[model samples]
Target: MNNSFSPRTGSPQAGSQQVGSQQVGRLYGVGVGPGDPELMTVKAIRTIAACPVVAYFCKRGTKGHARRIASDAITAEHEELPMVYPVTVELPPDHPDYGRQIEAFFDESAERIAVHLAAGRSVAALNEGDPFFYGSFMHLFLRLASRFPTEVIPGVTSMVSSASLLPRPLMLRDDVLSVIPGTLDEESLVRTLRHTDAAVVMKLGQNLPKVRRAIAAAGLADRAWYVERASMAEQRVLPFAEAPDTAPYFSQIVIPGEGKRG
Candidate 1:
């Protein structure tokens, strides 16, 4: 091959400057919505369907929540990538290796996504809730944003979805709504729940017992309403005081606002 000039074009340039810039693939972190496919925004559907590749986070051997919610838009033609977590509750969140293991998993997942981006293939990652709100997709977005083109499409969060099931309004006048995770310590949970106008406690799996106790201690037991699987077909709604022996991973406990903004 010639050292530096385009033989056919006869131009005095380094391979004709690569004949314009190469097409770069766009990376989209799309929030698939709480649970129901109907809740998925039109923009989300278009963005997801436009991408040639779709990626989602899932437990080992499982298809994942977001993937299931967005199945209507994703066809068999699109390549699916499942970013399985290296560790879940098996190791405590406080463990030193816990962070390391998760960090490694995200790092590897980002690399895998990057490969597709480099290949000029658009990729969309499906997230259950809003992608920016405490979602696993943020880790990958932060890693790849600086290096490639990335966009985030918002989705309905479980906080509002769970609130919709209640007869009372989540907020009335100047009421504030606070969302807390069940992973918080009992003392912290009580403190936060006691001060908030309305509260939604999420990530309720094995932490249901502790969260139930915290809601009682915070004096919001009667006000609190427990919702399991917000928009799914098997959704369950009940009083927080009646928390069952077992709750699924997607449960939410909501305390509707009392309209005390006056």
Candidate 2:
């Protein structure tokens, strides 16, 4: 695989367009929702069903969570394009090499998808959760949206799904909610948590221990609820203090805001 950033240029197409003798196709960034297939929106399902090619990002050895969630809508006739990652958590995200490698990989992926588009084959890029929210599909969208006719279909995010499973409202009355990533430095995490009335800390795999400490230090641990793989079959929900030592990447800690009436 070539690790170079080389983007091909083309005229954007709304529907099928006749670029000379060839017809160009539209691009769809379809959010497949979090975990459960039922959570997928009607528009998302319709888009996936209409497209001739389906694309998804995944780890080298996996079929991709997004593809799995959208499986019921996909048929055998759809051309699958699995954009495998070059590296996943092998190096620190702060490392320069990590950025360079990921950028190159995204560039290559965009080009690959562009090939299908230029050939007049409509491509549906499947994304887990909301495509605009921490979805890998964003990378491809940035590279391809301007050069192709594009539409982004929204879906249920894991954060909202977890909140529903908890059967708890995120914020009420005038309360504020902050969404934080567990990957932040411990001090930064603690600082952010202290100022927020309600919060959801995501990306808690190896950073579980650190995130727990930060939440505790912020005096929010007692209010936090730990949910693993929310909306999935293997789901587990527990109090923050009762949570296990290790957590999956899909796990999160949600601290609901204190309700108040004005």
Candidate number achieving the greatest TM-score relative to the actual structure: 2
Best model per lDDT: 2
- Candidate 2 per-residue lDDT, tens place, 148-208, comes to 7677777898998888877569888877788998889999999999887789999888899
Model 2, which residues run further than 4 Å from truth?
A: 1-22, 89-95
Worst 10 residues of 1 by lDDT: 7-16
lDDT of 1: 0.84
**All candidates: CA RMSD (Å):** 8.8, 6.1
TM-score of each: 0.88, 0.89
Q: Candidate 1 clashing pairs?
A: none
**Residues 48-110, candidate 1, lDDT per residue (tens digit)?**
778888999999988999999999998988999999988986898789999999999999999
